[model samples]
Target: MVLLERAMPTTLISMLAKIHGENPVVSEAKGVVPTCTCALMPKSGGKQGECKWCWRILVNREGLWFRVLASRYGLVGGRLKRGDRNGSVWWRDIASIRDGDASVLGSWFPENLSVHVGNGANTLFWLDRWVDDVPSCVRFSRLYDLSENKLATVAQMFSWGWKIGGEAWKWRRRMWDWEEEMVVECRSLLLTALLQVDTEDVWTWTPDPVEGYTVSVAYLTIIDRTPPTNNVLAALLWRKDVPMKVSVFAWRLFRHRLPSKTNLFRRGIIPSEAQLCISGCGQQESETHLFLSCTLFGHI
Candidate 1:
């Protein structure tokens, strides 16, 4: 675990802190749980330094973890889609991340990840972002609503023929002239989509296609997309020279996770009347007051 901690990038540590809902120091103390490092191992004859284990189950479809989940819950567009009530707690958590319910990590997956249609068996015809970086369902909402085969795969649609007057165009009702024009546009969009009969569909990490997905890259991408605020200070909090306890203290202070009287009252750990500065300054013992504004402690 210490070796894993050493292997982890500082940015990734911060990201994991956010995920685990704890300060980096506490998270580090817990240590990263062991996962299959087989996926992290470099391919035969590949670069020696390329091997690094990351918490990735989405893109590593061939990995044992992915295969086990896929076998149980099934997959759509090389991903586990929502609506599996029978899935395990872990699956639900992963689903939340994949479906954009887990905050930044959730949103990051869809925006930075994409699918390359090969055989198209693993690619959703409407939902996967295989064409032009946007899902067909999102691009052609009306057509998608009217279509009967909403869950159909790209290979299934192509096999049924996606062109005009094809069996793939199973609509709920006859479309008006304008809607038919949308169908025309949709068909034209699929004209260039050629599926490979021999190759399987694959997910591509858009930021680094060749190197593929890495937690470090994903963390950096999230940081980049996040509007800069206290980010600079947050980045500075994690330093090799600084003690872990100090960094954790700073992190808690910044995020209001400290056990200040105000925070304790807020969490129902104490009564409101008890939420006063320990120095008896009359001000609430909030983080700011205790750390920066208190007449007694502020001097130090």
Candidate 2:
């Protein structure tokens, strides 16, 4: 370990990598011996995000030491030692645990690992800690290589199998809470789109009274809600006592007769739009000429 007078701000991995993973604890590879290779596998264990194989559980990389684990852990799915039988075989079932026996880790180990057990086994690995220079992409490849022994989802394999720069991490991975919430939100949005719930109900809406009435109604979703809200006057010409669009003429008269911003209709204050025009034979074309007092239509 190196100590410095000034502080050095760095990433967690860089810090750990500097002190430990930087140096290969074991000069030889783990699980490379010709011994039994029965990596512990989970029978039904992805729920807790823990590896089922090699019951040696860990929260993160801090627990990557073999000395702390030793015989207490089951082997995770990894390379098989030379004499290693299938997964069902154990040290107890090996029939022989001696260093040269073909059925145990002791047998196929390289000369460095061929010595005493425990401390020696630990020493071999301490000298051979993982090669730090291997890119994270390569690190992921190692994991996937080990993962091939078990069932895998396409997403999982793609996630770990992908290699980019020397470093690798889940590029677009979501946390459990975020993933769950987004799934629900997306499902609802999709359903609404399929049902067309936010569309206009034109068929059930009141029919347009003129060529431009539909456009006016379209603008009415928020600006106006009924016929009275429109600047144009409306009259029920098709189904009323006045069959000749008389009501249309009547409201038209009412609008121009009143002043701008007039409350005439608001409280029935003023006269008609026709009243604002000349009263026939005169200066203004008031309602008198168009219908009632007009000399044109013959004084209705």
**TM of each candidate vs. truth:** 0.56, 0.15
For model 1, the run of ten residues with the poorest summed lDDT: 44-53
Worst 10 residues of 2 by lDDT: 45-54
Overall local distance difference test of candidate 2: 0.28
Candidate 1, which segments miss by more than 4 Å at Cα?
1-56, 75-86, 101-106, 228-300
Deviation from truth (RMSD, Å), model 1: 15.9
Clashes of 1: 0
Scored by lDDT, the top model is 1
lDDT of 1 by residue, 154-264 (tens): 989998988767999999999999999988998888878888999987777788898886544554464467553565555546756568898888777657799999889
